[model samples]
Target: MMPLIADLRNPAMRDRHWKQLMEEVNKQFDPHADSFTLELVLDLGLEHHQEAIAALSQAAAKELSIEEALSKIENLWETLPLDLAEYKGDYLKLRSVDDVYSALEDNAVALSTMKASRYAVAFLSTLDTWERALSHISETVEMLMNVQRKWMYLESIFVGSEDIRKQLPTESSIFDAVNAAYCKTMRELQDAGTAYKGTMAEGVLDGLNTMDEKLDKIQKSLDEYLETKRQAFPRFYFLSNDDLLEILGQARDPLAVQPHVRKCFEGIKSLEMKEVGKEGRKVHEAVGLNTPDKEQVPLASSVICAGAVEAWLLGIENAMCTTMAQLLFKCYADMKKTKRERWIKEWAGQLSLCSGQVAWTVECTKALHAMSEGQKTAMRQARKKQTTLLTKLCDMVRGNLGALDRKKVVNILTVEVHSRDTLDRMVKANCASVNDFEWLLQLRFYWEAGTDRCLVRQTNTT
Candidate 1:
């Protein structure tokens, strides 16, 4: 850490000013003697609070008063927008679009901030509520891991799409048509079954059942082909073998060259001819080459290079790994523990997606089957509900940014009443960025299927 412009504990410069302020606060309330320090601190904290509020315009404060900031939170409801258990889809989209853009702008402001969120006042005799002070060691370890993870991420950029495509089918062109065919056939068969009450063939339903079965078989065949392509993918992309070496890429299972700081012997034996050859040999070793004492390279930088290589080697080993030691297994183990935790989090997210898909699929089928007005309205609203809530949730979260203190917001969420339970938690989570908000919405809905991918996963697991 670098030193700051001013030392925080320099008492002489602002000593009298702080003392006068404490006396004023003490006069207002018949203050206790032993706890004068606490009262003095409170005075300083209040000063800071007053200063911060004064600095901001009411518009920036989002109409929150000091009392509300301290005691109550402003909220439409306690329910988080995303956590809302259920919502009308169209209503979600209608409310979210404006919210998304606003939140994105706020994230931009957060990124550009030169100073941290909390500030200190000049006359501040106050208790600083900084957390993470006791866990310095943990914080250091986290920083080191963060550095490694960042470099590893950069190395991953070197991995090209072609390298990944080696495992998939050579022709990407066939996939879209194949997918569309499968969906059409599945729908036709589903419709036929509903209309005729089985795969029975006669009159209007005659031969339609046979087409459905035949089309389904074709879908299965395409699936098999996709599997085969995966099995035959190549070991490496078309890079030169020494490309890694040129880029100073780490070697695979190779011994590392350790550099040592050595004091070379300063002597001249060049013109003598006799000792020239001996001196040449001695000087080579003296130049820190193949030295006896070598310091180990720092692991943080080393792991990044290693992680990158391992990621690629996994690609290669899938082509040829006799030992059955999959490269990804080791590479994944190298990631920060939190990354794995994030993977588990992804599962819960996936469940929402799957269920959404099932509902959408059911709705689309319903739309096709509905012959009258009332049934159609109910079916359409089911599809539109999630969209509407997602939109509103997005907008509402954006409006709250910088409007109120974060603690107050959290309290508001904890206690606020919501129109629906599903939207409550979604509101509480606080939209960190537009990306997070978008991801939450995407969790329940995949574009192509118009259904919940999370629900799909759930059913598969069962």
Candidate 2:
């Protein structure tokens, strides 16, 4: 048990054996009843490993010594001569014996005094501690720089554009916190006049962690905002965050979105944009779907704005839905005159595609224009009409199936086939999807040529 505990001190070994240790513990104690955690088991093992405890104690002591030394250096730097300060920057940049000689030639007196200082002696005496401390401070400084740069960029964007500020109001407080932290840290570092002061070092390290937390919060908020937009117009999901940001930031400029028009709309290759009215408002009024002939379809004009782009895009989708619904009804009307097998197949395919678009557009528009109660009522009515059309299309197709040729109906029922194979055959023969066939198959009874039978059971019924 002692040997196993010692072996577990190695991190690699502990990770590999973690599951085995848990299983072994479960044998003696009920994990559910005793509520035994892995932490408790590790603590038990660690208590017996006195040598590991000693090593940990020594590490913590070393860290304390380094901090004390740094704190003393910060105090000592105040009394140190101005010449000594000149050496501080150059000495910190030193990497080798050659660099030390090069720095000495530039500030020989200060370099000589710095080399003999007690702080320098302490640094040399504990090279490992100094290395770890310096590395940590460097990493924290780098993090601070990155956070400041990002905040500046985001701040400039929001400050310069009133439209963006109004559109994403939730980001105001988060950015304010980031701005305050960044300014406070920068002020402290500037007042200290040096990066190596212990107070600034500790503060910056703590600030770096805080910035990381704030950065994560900002990302979550941004994701939620983008997700809401995507829900309103699902095509926005295909765009990257940068691409979406660019479109939103320059929402007033219609041409800025021209490049991404194809990505957001499937059939559209580009938009025909123009300025109109006394206000000179830009609008996307037409989309050129990349057909083989390259014909353009005009959409209802929508004035571009930071918050209104989603509504504009949904308007285009709603237009497509209306067109598709009309085409589906036209197919249904044509079916009444001629119940040809090919015509039924084409109608089924159109119904399937049209139904999906109609349902999606109705839901999309509802959320996109959620603030308008009138618009919601209008969408509800539109959805009802589209639903009725879809139902009629399905019913007409099913009726046409009942009127199939007598010989084709016999050939289908008598064939030795699995349910899956039967559905596949029916889909291919009728040029409909498996869904359409399944809907038709739910019927328990069908009459054909003056005979009644359970169509799916392949049984005769008087």
Candidate 3:
């Protein structure tokens, strides 16, 4: 990259040669685009090519053809910096903008696929079938999430975790896509009912919904965790109860542990976690299966941290589910927010505003001319509100990540306890004198403390 620029840097080119080169470069954009002209770059750069970087940065911000320009700017960025690595870090922060663009593309693909019934597309449909036959769908999905989440975390840790001062924005965009597709899939399948006939067994739809909800929850947690991790190591992921306690320097009261009454994690050892992919399927069959033909759900699994919902709603979104539609609405809201944030960050630099403003709308008469009034308004509002909300979303993520890192350094965690009596106390005393031992279902056991910073520690049986 540096060599290419060096080849172009000639004293002969600086005079009349510069004008011709500028004209050639300027022609690379749509005539309709106000944001990408060689004259504007020169104006923004103000004679110094160093300022040209900022001009390019600002232009890259507004230009919808962002992904391509980012690659070009990246090549250009390489030749201009002394501390090349740190420049790379800043570039990474800006690259989160690329993540938003990529997400928008993925959502567009999924939506188009949904509209075209592309789940019926060979690969996706086979993937759907693969959902069944697997013993524990939730466990399978959860492990897939664990795989996906860890892959993402590793990206932040290894690829971007060079300097704490320079924040590298992690790309977080899976749930919006999965949720959008899931909802659309449900509607498609339901409406095409009879048209695409297949008798879903009892509890299958319930199980599928559960998997989708869990996936949504996983997406939310990973986003928050990644943000928190931005400030600290993403240790909360694989820490043990005892290690967590040791880090905090003291155990939080068994009475405080968190949103749930008890925190009993069955997976994770050290900072390493294995992919529970096929293994989870086995565990599902071993623990969940009973009859010759029926499939079963698992009795144990990891309880993913809900920092996103916790930070935003001040509790878990799971508890808000009085109905599936409400749950769908929440998923939709989350999807909308994620998509909006992606677009705003992606195009913010391109949008020329009244300088000094944190946010202001610039009408695109040509862009919106083809759309109906309602859609145009919605698109415009989305652009504005998305810019505002994304700022908050980023802040919320940073705050949670900061807390998570501090907790890691201090080695403390805060989880609350439950109030129910354990073993046979409730069984004998609350139930009847006949016997606490004589019971078919004793499905409630997680009553303990919740919340606060606590040290990482070892696992103990309930």
Candidate 4:
């Protein structure tokens, strides 16, 4: 026992020596071969080994829990944007229970920011206004999702179609209306989320319904428009909606039309396009192929790299844009002189209209008071009829007045516009640039359906 105890004291051999000594003590006290001793040994060797194992298990569990927490924190930290990289140095790596708690406290911002929208909702759930806030959030999300879903569907119709974009000004206006509603709803939603403030659920629901209706109308119109074009050009039916749109939209780019040539014409792999001169006039002629089975003849032979082609196209666009800008500049210059006076008169007329309503009301009141007792009986019947008509008229008047006040037309055109334009011309003369007119061609797709290829990609992906 003394030799075994000495072996257990050596840390390197402690585990093996402890197990061997425990086995010896158990065998010595076997029930069938038990022999009572005069003095009890009261072996404490097994007790020490059991206690050490239990303590080691608890320590390992605590260490594992700490590692798990640390791993979770690391994953959360990675979700933050690179601009917040400074937060990494602030992290605590302590391993104890208290240190783990402190580490969580230190990284609370990262945790909250990683799932910002979810955390925002969770935080609102604790407030007294949570019910109302929750309702608004739910409604807003529904509206935005519905709008996005519908827009993504209808947007496919106008995305790459220059013909539709140019000819269908109505679609652009419809999109603008939808976009304005969407933006307004988004602003309200953001305000609600941040302040836990609520708007009327009816208003949000109504907006969603209106947007859905408008999108349905757009879809119907686009379908008719697309079908008509396809009917006119039977080759357009060969290409998918997107491919046809690209080819039609980029009509000026002969290279863009090359890919779909084989689909449009049988036995034609590709069309041979050539730049005739520096002016960017492209001549495309179908050349008979030199097949082993048939004789072939060449029609046109000219070559130009893609860069030169782009440069030529840009030059053409520049010249056309400059001409359009000159015309618009002259028109705007002439109209600028008359616009202020015209807006002033228009607003003044509205003011006069409002004042006339007040005078009419006053006259009606005076007429009512002037009636004699005998005339009053007869006047009372007429007055009842007048009252109903006047109430409706007053409502209409008030509505018009409210709309005018909201716009502040006089302040906008007379004060704001005039002052801003004067200052603008002082700094840089009021002149139209080619850049200004370029956006005119782009206004149809200003909602980001044209320039943003991501929307098209998403539509395809879905």
Scored by lDDT, the top model is 2
Which order, best to worst by TM-score? 2, 4, 1, 3
lDDT of each: 0.29, 0.49, 0.31, 0.43
Instruction: For model 3, state the Cα shift of residue 210 in Å.
Output: 20
lDDT of 1 by residue, 138-158 (tens): 232233233223322322322
lDDT (Cα, tens digit) per residue for candidate 2, span 321-413: 655445555554465576444444444343333333333333423433442433334434433544554454544545545433323323322
Highest TM-score model number: 2
Which 10 successive residues of model 1 have the least lDDT summed?
A: 264-273
Tell how far residue 166 is off in model 2, in angstroms.
1.6
Per-candidate TM-scores read: 0.18, 0.42, 0.14, 0.32
Ranked by lDDT, the better of candidates 1 and 3 is: 3
- Tens digit of per-residue lDDT, candidate 3, span 6-50: 323322222333443445455333323566455754544324444
Question: Considering only N, C-alpha and C atoms within 3 Å, which residue pairs clash in candidate 4?
Answer: none
Candidate 4 overall lDDT versus native = 0.43
Question: Regarding lDDT, does 2 or 3 come out ahead?
Answer: 2
**lDDT comparing candidate 1 with the true structure:** 0.29
Candidate 4 residue runs with Cα over 4 Å from true position? 1-140, 153-163, 194-202, 265-267, 277-462
lDDT of model 2 at position 205 = 79
